[model samples]
Target: MKIIRKSDPVNLRRTVDQGTVEQRKIVQSIIQDVKENGDQAVLSYTERFDGVKLVDYKVTSEEFEEAYDSLDGEYVQILKEAADNIRAFHEKQSTKSWFDTQSNGTILGQKITPIDAAGVYVPGGTAAYPSSVFMNIIPAQVAGVERIVMVTPPGKDGKVPAGVLLSAHILGVEDVYKVGGAQAVAALAYGTESIQAVDKITGPGNVFVALAKREVFGDVDIDMIAGPSEIAVLADDTAEAAEVAGDLLSQAEHDARSSSVLVTTSSSLAEQVQSEVEKQLADLPREEIARKSVEDYGMIILCETWDEAVDTINEIAPEHLEIITEDPFQELGKIKHAGAIFLGPYSSEPVGDYFAGPNHVLPTNGTARFSSPLNVDDFVKKSSVISYSAQAMKENADKIARFARLEGLEAHARAVEIRKERWKS
Candidate 1:
């Protein structure tokens, strides 16, 4: 791993910018082809990339029923339980429009409306994460999105993973399409013959999917350009090395691009955690990927003070920040930028990923500085409501007209001027 002592800002930005341009171009082409050709283009790409020849792009009702029948009872129960957790958590974020009435009869408020439809893209790579299904759907459901459409690439045998189907069924997602990558995003952004265009798209995917979402953002609303998974541990001498290593490896096993960093002021604890990572990586199943991730992106920095360590963490703005110090609460207010903050030793990353009731879909690539974790707010939009009485309009008309005329917008000024005379009554 590249361990620098907090003086390599130049190399850091360069590393983040790597491969983004090429990725964007590739994703752009895929989106254009899908937008131009529609279902025919989708079928061609599906067959070429996923090796699944499909006469029908959408999953049939019979197939959904069969998927339900095929799943084990125990696993189905688990999916239901996870859905309940996600639903409960997101329900707290549901917001409603509110209005305030004043003596002057001016009605001012905000109206919160759920999106018409939502598209969720799930990855079909190394493994099927059913938790992602719950994470993506629960927010839209809480926001009262009318339709939830899911897209995932089929396996070589021309079928979606059983777990994916089970999760969708449990979440009550009716529309499921066997398409993936930028092509799937294109299908969602611009409707095909079978698939309906959606108001927004959410969920996490590989670099192609991330780049595709980035390209088609204006065409359709997206959750975020989710990059690789990451976890940063802020530990002190009182922390246990095994817990820190375990939390780091939890994200490291995600992909080779995944990063697991440790920022601490304890030298002996740093060495112990390093040894623990090596020991844990040896017995781990995804060691090859985790090792590459740890080697390329992982770091163990020893700082002179906890304040220095927290400052460095703020600069890095990692996706997941785990503080396993003597007093995690004392440092919580110091953390300004992080997708999710896990405090103390027991608060592990997987807890939030699975049953902790917090949305696991978070901002990556230092986007947490401005972006936010996915929530019900992502699926709902607010429209400002302005209603002025005749008298009120007459009172404010000249001010509005003058402001508009100041900007050289004669038509806008005239619109207010005309309304002023008409409402004078």
Candidate 2:
């Protein structure tokens, strides 16, 4: 970790993998083939990419039972509690259709409607991420989306990870599929024989999957073009160096491109954390990956004042932020740009990633400045409702006509005028 003085600037941005021209070409070809051949293309690509030949891609009841039996009863209980917490948190985000009736009988409102279906793609990496399953599905369920389809790459043995299956079973997501990569995204966007097309797709994946999501975005709504993981800790002298170092390493171990930064006002704390990070990295299981991240993208900045620390954090617009100052709440209000804010030492980043209720799918690559964390709102859309009474239209018809005509939209102006004339008759 590098120590940046007050005068120096810290750059935490990673070159997000947008996929090469060759990769993009492959993704396009895959999407086109899936669109034309449906399930045949999906199976072909699944075998090519996932190294499995599946007679049927859907997970059966027998497989779900295996998933349950494979995992310990204690770990399953933990997953259940986590799922409940996630569902309860997202339930608060559900919205109802609302209408406002005016004295003149005009009814103006917004109708909230959930998308008919959503596709959640869980990545098959070094390990299975059941956390991704809970984060993506619970919000769609809470929003009243009737259908939630889950897709993931099958192992060479032709089976999805038990942890992922267990999480889905806990959430009651019965439509799990054994497919992944760009092909899975294509199947979601355009229906196959076994899979139905989804209105929206959500979840994180590799560069190829990200490319597929980018390609199919307009055809079906996507969550976001997510980048690598990132975290920025804002701490002061009161913060413990060891705890701060551990929190920083937790994100660093995610990916080499992952950014871990500490912006603090205390020079002594900064020096101590920098040393502690290097010492702790030696013992991390993912030492090589964490070391690369800390060496390249990590930073320990020394700020002269609290205002400077806050301003720098806002500029970075980190994906996850932790405030470990004596007054974390006061600092929280001052800070304005973070995907998820954790206050004090107890609120560690992984707490939200696993057991905590908040969605872990957050904006990255400084995207938190404008975007937000995934919620029930992502699964549902709003339609504006307008009911103009005769009295209300009569009162404002001329103004509406003039405004429409100002845009050189003669048809729009005439449309309003024709309605008024019909009422006049």
Candidate 3:
């Protein structure tokens, strides 16, 4: 890891991917094919991209039973507890329709309505993450969505991971399909014969999936175009070098492009943590991947003061920020950006990523400056309720008409005037 002062002119931003020309053309073609041919195109792409052939794409009750039987009883109970935690957290975020009547007889309010259906894509080509199933599906359920479907690429043996299926089973979701990549995204956006289209799509995938989400955004909503995972730690001398290094590598092991940064006031602490990261990297299971990440995107900054460290963190606007100062709670007010904030040394990033109730799907590539983590609000929409009464309209008609005419909207002005005329008659 390279250590530098905060004054160094190093660029802290990672370039977000927009897909190559060939990639974009391919994604467009896949979406068009899925839209036209439906299930046949889906099956064809599943065979081509996922390297598997399926007679029928949907998961059956027999498959669900197999998944349940395959997983250990202890692991299944743990998933149940995690699902409950996720459900509890998202339930608190649920919104309800509200209305208020005005003294002048005008009724105004907001209606909160969950979308009809949601499709969650679980990344499953290499590794299986039951945690993602919890993070993505629980929020939609809390928002009261009627139908939820899961889509993932099957293994070479033509089976979705037992853990992924078990997570769905625990959540009471039975609709799943053995599909992935751009084709899976296309099917969710535009209905396939077997898989119905959804109002929104959530979860992460490879480059093709990201590009497909971008292409189908207008037709269907997406959570965000996620980049590689990132974490920024702001700490002082009081934080342990080994523990800090462990936390940094936790995110680094995620991908080669994943960024792990350490911002500290003490130069000595910076040097210690830097050495500790190198020492710890030798033993990680994903050592090669994490080493590339640490060598490429990893950074250590020596800040002159606490204020400077906090400012540098805000500038990075990382997907995950860990505050390990002497008093993390006191320092929190200074933080303005970060998709999720972990405080104190014990609150490691994985706690939020797995067992913790908070959604792990967060904004990446400095997007925390304006965006937010996945939550219940992403699954539901709000509609304005305006019940303008005759009393309120009569009192404001002339002003409304004049304002509309000022914008040269004669028809808009005349519409309100016509209503008044009818009332007078």
Candidate 4:
């Protein structure tokens, strides 16, 4: 792992922004082709990449039913439990459109409305993550989205993964398609003969998928361009190095681009955690991936004090921040920017990713400084509700007219003046 002293801020930015302009251009070309050709392009890309010829794009209801029946009871039950937790967590974030009216009579408030349709793109390469299904779908469900359309790439056998099917079944996702990659994104943005267009698309995927989403953003909204999994553990002498190491490795195993950094004030704890990461990584199934991640992007920055460590963390703006100190709750106030803050040693990144109510989909590549985790809010939009009685309009008309005239908006002033003369009498 790379070790740097606490003096550099620009170094962090340089380390994280690794993707090139050429990659983005290549993805852009693919997106445009799919947009133009529709299902033909989607099918061709699917056959080329996945090595499966798809006759049908959408997964039929019978397929979901058969998959649900075929799945093991144990795994199915886990999906249900996780979905329940996700639903509950996002339920709290659900809001209703409300209006307030005074006797003088102006009704002004905000109306929260769910989007018409939401698209969820679940990654099918590498492995099937049922957890991601729950995280992406439940929030839109909670927000009362009319329909949730899911897209996943099929395997060599021309079928989606059993876990992916089971997850779709558990969430009651009726519309699922076997299409994936930039073509799937294009299909979702501009409806094909089979797959319907969606208002917003959400989930994590490979670089091509992210780049496609970026291209289709104006045509359809997207959750975020997720870079890679990242975790920052803030530790001191009191924290357990093994737990810290495990947490760091958990993120590292996600992808080679994944970053895992440990910012600590205690030199002894930093040394212990580094040793522990090496020891634990040896036993990991994804050891090579984690090793490369640690070798390339990982860091153990020795801070002079806890306050300095916190400042460093804010600058890093990690996607996942774990407070593994003696009093983690006390340190919570110091953390200003992070996608999700895992408080205490027990609250690890996996907890939020799998079981915890919060959505695991988070901002990465230092975007935690601005972006946030996916939630019910992303599925819903607020519209300003304004109503004025004749008396109310008359009372406020002079003020409106005066302000408009001050801004040299003659038409704006005239509109209020036209209403004023009639309402005044």
Q: Output the number of the lDDT-best candidate.
A: 3
For model 1, the local distance difference test gives 0.86
Model 3, residue pairs in steric clash: none
| Model 4 per-residue lDDT at 414 | 90
Q: Give RMSD (Å) of candidate 2 vs. truth.
A: 1.5
- 1-425, model 3: which lDDT tens digit per residue? 99989999989877679989999999999999999999999999999987888999999999999999998889999899888888888888877899999999999999999999999999986579889999999999999899998999999989999999999999899999999999999999998889999999999988899999999999999999999899999999999999999999999998898999999999888999999999999888999999999999999999887889999999999999999988999988989999999999889999999888999999999999999999999999999999999999999999999999999999999999989776856
- Evaluated against the true structure, the overall lDDT of model 3 is 0.93
RMSD in Å for all candidates: 2.1, 1.5, 1.1, 1.8
lDDT of 1 at 290: 96
TM per candidate comes to 0.94, 0.96, 0.98, 0.95
Give me the runs in candidate 1 sitting further than 4 Å from their true place: 1-4, 7-25, 422-425
Sort by TM-score, best first. Answer: 3, 2, 4, 1
Candidate 2 lDDT tens digits, 1-425: 98988687545555457888999999999999999998899899888887788889999999999999999989999999999999989988888999999999999999999999999999886668999999999999999999999999999899999999999998889999999988999999999989999999999988889999999999999999888789999999999999999999999998887899999989899999999999999888999999999998899988888898899899889999999988798887888889999998899999999988999999988888889999999999999999999899889988999999999999988888888767756
Q: Candidate 2 — which residues are off by over 4 angstroms?
A: 14-16, 422-425
Clashes of each: 0, 0, 0, 0
Cα lDDT tens digits, model 1, 313-348, are 887788999999889999999999999999988999
Residue 90 CA displacement from its true place in model 1, Å: 0.6
**Residue 352 accuracy (lDDT) in model 3:** 95
Please identify model 3 stretches exceeding 4 Å from their true place: none
